[model samples]
Target chain A: MFEEADPDLLPEGLSDRLPPLAAEALRVTRAMNDVLAGHGFDPVQPPMVEFERSLASRMAGTKRNRMVRFVDPASLRTLALRSDMTVQVGRIAATSLKDAARPLRLSYAGQVLFLKGNGLEPERERLQVGAEIIGNDTVAAASESVSLAIEALKAAGARDISVDFTLPDLVDTLAASSLPLPEAAVPAVRRELDAKDAGSLVAAGGEAYLPLLYATGPFATAIEKLAALDAGDAVASRIEGLKEIAAHIDGAARLTLDPTERHGFEYQSWFGFTIYASGVRGALGRGGTYRITSEGGHDEVATGFSLYPDPLIARGAGSAKIERLFLPLGHDRDAALRLRTIGWQTVAALDASDDARALGCTHVLDGKEPRAL
Target chain B: MFEEADPDLLPEGLSDRLPPLAAEALRVTRAMNDVLAGHGFDPVQPPMVEFERSLASRMAGTKRNRMVRFVDPASLRTLALRSDMTVQVGRIAATSLKDAARPLRLSYAGQVLFLKGNGLEPERERLQVGAEIIGNDTVAAASESVSLAIEALKAAGARDISVDFTLPDLVDTLAASSLPLPEAAVPAVRRELDAKDAGSLVAAGGEAYLPLLYATGPFATAIEKLAALDAGDAVASRIEGLKEIAAHIDGAARLTLDPTERHGFEYQSWFGFTIYASGVRGALGRGGTYRITSEGGHDEVATGFSLYPDPLIARGAGSAKIERLFLPLGHDRDAALRLRTIGWQTVAALDASDDARALGCTHVLDGKEPRAL
Candidate 1:
């Protein structure tokens, strides 16, 4: 009887959305998709489940354990749920649509479940809004993705969204040095470098790799610092790539080159960036380039970004302005039909009209009377 | 070593979306939201996980056990991953937004995960697009939800969409009878009733319930059949309510009434409907009215529909007509900038242009040639 009375009890780390926040997030996601679509990024959806082997590939990285896994009763194969859309795009580009095209531009919005211990404050499931650019390996491709990310943020009503650009190769070079580093020491090394701690990195390694480890800052300063590094050639090339991207973006002033911003999935290669709005502690959106080996026998380069809509809603970012139409308490069906035909989205009660007004609805009508709520 | 390689593998029943289906589904979801928003349905996103007790109380008698369950380490309280968004909406309405006004018109689009053994052939994780109309129980509210569902289907390029309408009270009357219904014999009973097997139902339930069980046809014919049922005045009043809803829909001619179409979660009450379109054998969308009782002394009545986007994409529905902008292999940064400034979404490769063309893009610019692809 207890079970019969309550069958829908949800497990931990999940939730249902209701009015105001859920509605606001939907509006933000839609507006972001619009800007992305307007910029010619086509949207796509992949099944949430895939072969566990496919999901466990190196390309998926530590994200593998976070997935919830189960055996398919019908096929008896180990099927795992997808944690991210980019890797799924990799699979689709490799197998499903492999013959049709190259350099596919795809966008997606869906929920991604991660295993506990990722350090999410609430450890909640994420409704990720993201876009992936598969099949292109050019500075322009990277730049276009960054531009679109900026535009999407702006469309979501972000006032001061700034882009922090970083080169993964810079950190990779430092990690490759002879430092006798334990596996767990890597995160510490990354943290120190991200903090621009030249002193600590030199203490851990020798003075030989100090210049490379210390080469980090806002975009302009990082570029100058990279030129002064001992591994100047590799660092110089990455800086040049960043410079090329900056030249193409109209608001280059908003670009910050933070050589120390090192936290990301290991798959990230070449140029990576994080987007932030004023007052938001974490990035509102993020993306970078990566390489994936294709079924057709070559590694394809790609870049993508996923926007966290919850934070934007927390900041009151993306609600749409609408007019309200209110029907009286007992308005007849004919009257409601007449009002709908006139393009008024009628609320069927005076109380609902008051709620609509609170949600920033500009116009209100009670039956045929156009009155301000 | 294995753990170090891939850490973020998704949990069971979740997925990543890829193009052109991902792109197509996003467009369709956006259009549906727009139609709902135009009708004053604000968007909302509930948490992906919630307390098990909260969800279970709301999901009584449904197939909700398919939801993956877990214990939150912080609280040591049982929690469940959300299988659907409706109950979460109820939670929010009851708790956080309790003071907010009534008649909350809300819409949402997100991925929902269902556990195995629910009898859905394809994977249980799905991109669910839906809206909920809360607080009001008027025929107009019901009509508006139906109209929005129809418009959303039309916008999604459904050429031959059909709505199958049913009433819960009518089905309850058949279930309440003391007929000797065997557990193994019930599916056959349902199938026959779904087929409008008046003779079979009469033989199975005997003459006492035959009149009520046999009522089925197009909307008008079913109304007459329902009138002849041997049920009492209360059941007759419920039938009258269903007829009123049937009459208010604009395209009422397209509705088919099936008293036996009782497939849904147990939360459903009053009217129910399923939408079918070409190339889709199963329901493209399903919705009905439900009454929820909250622990906080809040009782709310609501109804809405959820459209499954994966099947629509699999059936090649909701393809957007996008214009393509192609840059030559080595187009200069200035040229790319100019194209973007002029509102053309420029891609860096010729292949990307081909994908755009396949998606109904006519304008393609490759180097000096700006012509239709």
Candidate 2:
């Protein structure tokens, strides 16, 4: 029957993770989640399907579009599989834990399905592990989140992860300034700034914003450079916030400054960041400060980061091979279970003639003690 | 704003699990996975979405219908979210692990979303955890699966769990018997046998099948009762198989026999089982022996069991309450980081005037000394 109906012909962009690889993902998720828990980040689980209307409010405009929607048979409502988990966790923080405290910490890890893969990330479904801190958006909170992100990556054995900080709100300040560019030039100006192209910025009639564009490097140097620019109060406060965060970030990781980089994050109006690990392709994950408007017309500060465990699993960092002990045919069931209770992987031999050691077993027992193969 | 577009207004039947509940689910899943692993069951992760046609081949017709389907934008293929994980794992063990070894052992855990709930279990989305032994569907395999399921439930802190065994193949044997019955009598015969109504069974042209129904009880009693029946090889083989399984399953848990209990599992050709823990609502999960057809025109004996942690989590045997340590404004970041390294949940104070003790903090550091609140 499998010949005619082989389910091995999987859908494009979908996959089955077998053996050690699967074990690796689970291991990495647990390690990262443990790190978050150590920092007071609680855990949350959000269902895979939700009404499309309700799903939309959970994420920003760009991220929400990637959700795969279907009509639920029972309710006749359009349901969407979660594309992002932060939104769902935020939803919980806003309602379930709304009155618990001034600041709340929560962590989560699960799979998220997308309508399509973005860029080079080909798998449509991904393993997402994340942590979010709600109610405080100050520099101290930002530093704590970034620090924890670095520590989580370390726990997952990610090497040389670079936490690059950005000012997602920098463009708004520049666009409304004295050296105002026409509305049509905004797109080109944004492109040049993100590219860190000083020549292109000047050529696009944004010559006055060159100092800010040049302020891209290590924390202290960039802040000094940014201070020299003719910036508005919004931009200045953001810089001041960065200084406070810098004071609190005590040598846990290297921090780079990319003052004008905004991709995959349009809702963030304050500090934003992306992390890249050495020798690993693409950013591991990104997170930063954002304004979370509550149900009562009030705003709260939120910051957190999510790490994709696939890369870590691909690098083979999570789990170890299982050691096995074998029992010859008609072996004692109690003996096998007893061996298992002490954390031994016991295999009951189906045939007496079968060589247990040849079957990849470490030890064998046949009423003659567990002897090494 | 949340008032205008609160994501917390989730779609019907979809909900968020916060704090201790989420941690509990994770804990239970890990404990169960550990038990399976100790028994030589390897872990596998099947993606959340798959091709509908391939998915259909993974489950029985009754379950396949409950799978939620949607169209993929890129591949233009009709994709379905996994309503069941057994099929995906089966697909892997048949194809990917096809040549690895005989009698392969694999385990998995993940979330499943259905088009609609089955029976009294109304939650459209459910968490599934299971371990499967492929290539050896012998009585030993069945015994191991049942024993492992009981061990897993205990590892998850389930109380007084009971495993109920059934002969799903008995009905087909009875239907193909020598006696001829009216079409309308078929339902009545099945009902009588399922209810153990020996009198009704005689009236419905099923008098010859009464012994199998009357044999439902504990293992030794059931086999003794079955021995008194005038049976063909087909009916006699089932009783013989049960006896072998009973001999192998010792000191695991209580086991009961139900010869005519058929629901949600029509694909199984032989032994089928469901597990329930006392003081817990609903069956934790079910599994049994089935013919897993290989790619090369051969059927391998397969046996496995799945356990849902939700019921155990509902019983509240997961993670302990999270403890908190508050650091006053401008406290040392290194001190906070060091404290967290030792399993302390460190939360930095956001406001100077805020009462750290009243904020659910068990300890605080305010320059004077580190003191318990």
Candidate 3:
């Protein structure tokens, strides 16, 4: 007889969220979603799978290879599991919501999958909670996006929140006028600047772009230094836009500036930002102004942020133990129901010899009232 | 120029849930999940994808072919998107919570995907919300599963809910003793009985099981008719169990009994039920006493129900328009914050020309209070 392999083994990069951890994750998701909704962001839910081209074409820099793809049995066409829902929201805005009012505020929270994990991050699946302000990407919209992202993180119990601003299109803004670079050398310059290596920055024929490396850190002084740079008209307006956005969310969170940071802001246009909090490892979420491709392939400006709050959830998971009331056999059902309505978690006994503490109950229902055991 | 295919074209059976409909789905899910939690069922979240062998081997009758499968690039192993979450819950109970406590109550709500649509229904992805009572499948456990499922549906705003009970293993129990059949002839007998064709049942060597076909309808009469059948000890015990379960939820929901209905009760053992509501097109949910396969391949008795409330959600979708408050440019930010805290969905204007009614606002924030449009 052949021995069967272990049935409890989970796939690599995937695991079960058990007990209080699962409860905490739900709470965090609800908190973030509630914050989004309170600000009039209507919720939207897109199917987990879609045509590979649909997802890839909605936004620039959405890598098709990163999404888990398979041939759909119904369509006989390849379908990709969504690696990012921002693109799907863009699709919704451009199609189903094309006739809706301008600056359509749509929010979503769901599991997103990737074919491969990011470097040093073993997790391939994450909870992406986000809100998109479609049809506008003004400085006011940028300000609202940054402030809302901070508020959402605070609601989910993150403290000492920080917003690091970035200019996804800073190179384009500069190369067009102020700091000219050969057309072919643009990618190399962006790559070197993202790496923050001055030597590589000069080697890429971007010696003039070296000033951007210094024009970063603590938003107050950084923005002023960036403003002092003679980058002509386009760069000047963007600098002022960043200043206005920074002033709007100044006291809400610690502010920083990295005008040319482009790690996760692949499709963002003029402005981008990454959020962080003390005690939470890495970035809590990222947001910025960007564009959505319409059905006619025309670009519509939008601003939004997507928050991957797994770290926040993990940090808070299993820390809070719920007060459970054990209801003995023959206890009043109506009484138990009433208690449940009042927020008491009642675990009813099935038979005799059932122990309350063993079942993790903090209280036992004695007659009508819960008596701590 | 090469004309591109529509970027908004989603894969067949997949869709983007827009605005109010998406909000309704979230509300329905939360309402049901809250009911489960109030009943002391600790929430658990399992990943959308798992190893094919892990998912398939955890429970009997979970079809591997029905799940959407893809090769995991990291492990070079086949990974399957879950078609049913019950098996995943069973695996969690048998492993992670294996030593915590007996009679563990767990609840979950998430998306489940299928490779193929069911019969005439074109949906391949559905929101599956459910709760499981692990380590016990007693009459009381079965009773709780039935009543809790009803309560959840009611909480989600379903009206005139009904529960149709079935015994998944009815034929096997009877074929062993009271109405004996050749071991090889059992499948045909069960199939014929399920089809409700008396002539075919007799031709299929299930003539002795003829009365079982008539033993279905309203729980009161059907159960009495079933009880009158002389099927001896095993059948007698099951009949008593059914009676006890019915008595527990007597007035809560309209009850019916179909002792051999096996459509959606594939892995259920002694008892199974399908729940429905008036105005909803099909069954809202189903549950039963069943067995989960332990890592050592030993069967552990468990009872649970999974509610696919898509039809219910669709019926309620777009029926509720939220009351939104619009704040004009330069409106008091603190006043708007206070209003939002009290559940007013406030959408702030980006410019002076922004119209309140055009943005779906039912009222405009005049000073501190909302003035109806």
Candidate 4:
């Protein structure tokens, strides 16, 4: 009977970050944010909830169904807990920071809530740390984003990093001109490409898109294969842009090409890349070129990346243990402050019977210095 | 036509933190969390949402109405966004960290969402930074909490800090013996005391509780007035506990006594405190002794404080300006990294037309050295 009434039960797909894991999460987030700041990305914080229309309209492909929603008591408008913070940064660029500068660099780190878990990933809440370069989607902006992403992941203690590039609008780019197809067949062709099913691509009237499937793995070879395909000049500039970005981050991180990989690149445009590390379970993060559509229907180009560092943190990356000093009852307070100033964690005794080792302290305060227990 | 579909509008009581203000919020949160960690408080992160029953039933006085709730599709159970993180800490102490040392110290910093804003405050979402001293609620525990809270607030750039102390169960302690009342009249007495209406307090059959109304002033004077009240020896030990806690933080902050003050001290017991700082619009934080009721119906004492530092962040405290160096096209990348290593924020130009001053850079990179703009 009491089991059913347990007050400690957390909801499914959620759990508390206890001890070292919690510290690791904070450290990894700070490290990544610091990397962004070092590159002149000023940090910005967007509230966790916003009007559903506001959240969905700032960026195309931001699905309203993914966000948890409720009616706002004040406005009677539907409010949504943010499923992605990228749109929020876009909103800020279009409104509050609209006049700040061109090619604005802003960073944000926050918890985003989703209405449901996707596929095998049962995490409804995740910590997203990212940087956005607004007002420009040039080849230079794309290159900067790719380089900064690789650097940020390395700063967070991720090892053997790899980046897999994609062109989110590749199908649209091809279908518009060189590889003409009926507008109705576009979605099916994109789906078949994502499924990597060549037979299904033909069934979807995308027989000419088969060459795109084999253009995967090693960036250098894959780019050559994609360039050799007879899609005319429709994707010529895009292929050259991808080559430039790959050259920029060549020595820093392992690079690959999959022009049709569209798993999490819902709002990405011409360029996109997914990051991975040797020991991590899934893709560490993704970034690419995109556009922020303003309230007046004007679209401003931009490039950025958002990193879901939970997997990296869960692997115990970047958490450093500190020395702790136990202060007995009646210990000198000034002496304890001195120790703390030099980086010692101090826990004072509440009473005479309190034990030092039991409180997780490795040393006892001996006058002003910490003496090993 | 665009006005109806504007996506830039945030819900009432919600706003974005842009530019310097956003950076300041991060700095303030880090300073307070650092103070917590220096005192040996291990960091923990509880998810933003939990089961409605789990959250509402963790600690006494946690109202379910304050939480924003919705159905969890996976569990088919009601899920509520956390309105307070203190009860979540209590649940962790009783469950996940049950076998840890006595007097466990845990710190947490996160965003909490409420269903509605309180009168005058008008903030439905807030950042709460706090530390808990679980497994103990002794006078020493209360003293540590008071001292830590003041220190944390000061570290976050608060000045002229003041703490108002109260006994949340004062009426219960009095009505049980000295000023006995019908069980039904107890809540009315509490309401009248909170309102500070002397006439209504008497009308509520709390005539003998009138002395507590006079016990509201500076700590030294008001504590004495409370001591002079002709109650049985019921409040004698509690008054002593308050005195000891005051003495511990005597020189650190201004102290006051209001034994019947019970506005937001819903779950507090023998001791409670509300912290205020000079220039801040309202209370910075509150803490006191409380008991955590486990699923087994066992009560374990705890003392803690949660600081809402948004007011201080809004005041632009703790944000430091850094000189940004703009790297023109074809500038040295290694030199820029070296400049960043020595604390210069570097923003590289995306193209030749990008202006340094427009991007908020105080200096531009001239070879390896920064030339003031």
- Global lDDT of each candidate: 0.65, 0.77, 0.88, 0.88
**Winning candidate number (TM-score):** 3
| Tens-place lDDT digits, model 2, residues A1-373 | 5335554677767787777788788778888888887776778998998766655664573356688887777766677888878777766777777776767788899998888886787789888888888877777778888888888888887987777889987876678774577878888888888787889988987788788777888877988898777576777788888877666566666778878878856767688888888878888888887766545454577887777868878787334766788887777767776787778887776545555665568887657467777
* lDDT, residue B154, candidate 4: 93
For model 2, how does the per-residue alpha-carbon lDDT over B1-373 read when each residue is reduced to its tens digit?
4335554576656667766788888888889888887877778999898878767764563356788888878767678888778888777876778776767889999998888874677788878999888877777778778878888889998877777778886766657663445667778888887777788889888787776777777766876776677456777777787777766666466778877788755677688888988988879989888776544454567888777878788677444665678888878766776777778877677667656765668888656345778
Tell me how candidate 2 scores on lDDT. 0.77
Per-residue lDDT tens digits for candidate 3, residues B38-134, read 8889999999899887778766778888888998888778899998888899988877787768788999999999887877778889999999998
In candidate 1, what are the lDDT values of residues B245-326, reduced to their tens digit?
A: 6666656328787765676735667777888877777888788888767754678888787887677665554344545676
Candidate 3: residue pairs that collide? none
Worst 10 residues of 2 chain A by lDDT: A1-10
Interface CA root-mean-square deviation for model 1: 6.0
Enumerate residue pairs that collide in model 4.
none
Task: Order the candidates by lDDT, highest first.
Answer: 4, 3, 2, 1
Which ranges in model 3 have alpha carbons more than 4 Å from their true place? A1-3, B1-3
What is the TM-score of chain A, computed separately for every candidate?
A: 0.82, 0.88, 0.96, 0.95
Model 1 chain B: lowest-lDDT 10 consecutive positions: B2-11
Q: Each prediction's interface RMSD?
A: 6.0, 3.0, 1.7, 1.5
True contacts kept of each: 0.46, 0.75, 0.81, 0.78
Give the runs in model 4 whose Cα sits over 4 Å from its true position. Answer: A1-4, A182-185, A199-207, A317-319, B1-3, B178-185, B199-207, B230-232, B317-319
